[model samples]
Target: MTIKYPAGGMVSKDVQPVDDDSVELTLRDHPLIRRYGRLAYLVIHGEPVPAGRPRFTRQGHAFDPKRSRDYKKLVSEAAALQYHSELLHGIPLKVDVKVYRHVQSSISKVERAKRLSGKHRPIVKPDASNYLKLIEDALTGIVWEDDNLITDVSCSKYYSDDPRIEVTVTETGAKRPNNLKEPHY
Candidate 1:
């Protein structure tokens, strides 16, 4: 806490000595005491925390505190501004969820492999735990208004337009001329 004085007002140059047994002064009566002494005394013993601070503009500018006439509103606005920086980085936002089918290893096939190998050959196989995976993406068009942040989550695969050259075709690929034999009855 800092102490300030009027432009022309004179303040004591020397500090006063306290009694040997004096306890350190605390602000139990006045949580904050940087205001006029008359009002401060009225609130020192039984006053609620005063509501007096400057409002912040939407563009992040704070108006001169001395010019603010509504002390309570000023204080409230300042409180909102004080925490704005932290909020933007960790805002708890709702993201649009997109779910689609992905080729997962058939669980039955994995079980058969494991049983045949007596759990020693390869119990944990690639594509063994084939199941639906949910892809979550954050939509940046909205601002988060909640207090908690979404740091940890479950995920699968995300859809994007990036091009890639896969060497081998998947099992569901379209039938080709050489592989077009009909199933025998």
Candidate 2:
């Protein structure tokens, strides 16, 4: 006989979307704790490198002090940004991470307007998933004791004059917050 996995573990399986049934945590103002800026990156051979693989010199030894410092600072900020008294455990967590990044300055005025109007979507590097990974790792202990307590996650990227990440985390089976209108995120 085959055993069935639990249904609530996946966002795709969510019966009712976060709607009016979860707490909303917004962290756009806090710089270090809010979003990972696209401009902050590790450079090698004059090109910024993505996290995952280690960079090396001619001798094949790797060292990236700036990158290490950036990561640690981000994690520390994550811990500091969390709501101190909130009990974020036991229940399944549904998070919505909307990443706001700065648009390149080289684009023409018309193009910039289009971007600002949301008529044209910016397709660039520094993938959204990478930012989400950093957030998950950084918020592990402070947010919920462990990252495994998270049951659902929603992540997106957008262009903004002020770059930031708007994070909303909610626990299932909890009383809904009073001032919710739309379920859409």
lDDT of every predicted structure (CA atoms): 0.25, 0.53
TM-score of each: 0.14, 0.55
Off by over 4 Å in 1: 1-98, 102-138, 143-149, 157-185
Candidate 2 residue lDDT tens string, 14-80: 1322233435543333343346421111111111122344468999899545664355345435344
Task: Identify the runs in model 2 with alpha carbons over 4 angstroms from their true place.
Answer: 1-65, 68-72, 78-82, 173-185
lDDT value, residue 85 of candidate 1: 19
Clashing pairs in 1: none
Which 10 residues in a row give candidate 1 its minimum summed lDDT?
38-47
| Residue 126 lDDT, candidate 1, scale 0-100 | 20
Error of 2 at 135 (Å): 0.5
Model 1 lDDT, residue 144, Cα: 25
User: For candidate 1, lDDT tens digit of each residue in 41-90?
Assistant: 10000011221344789999975344223322322232332222122223
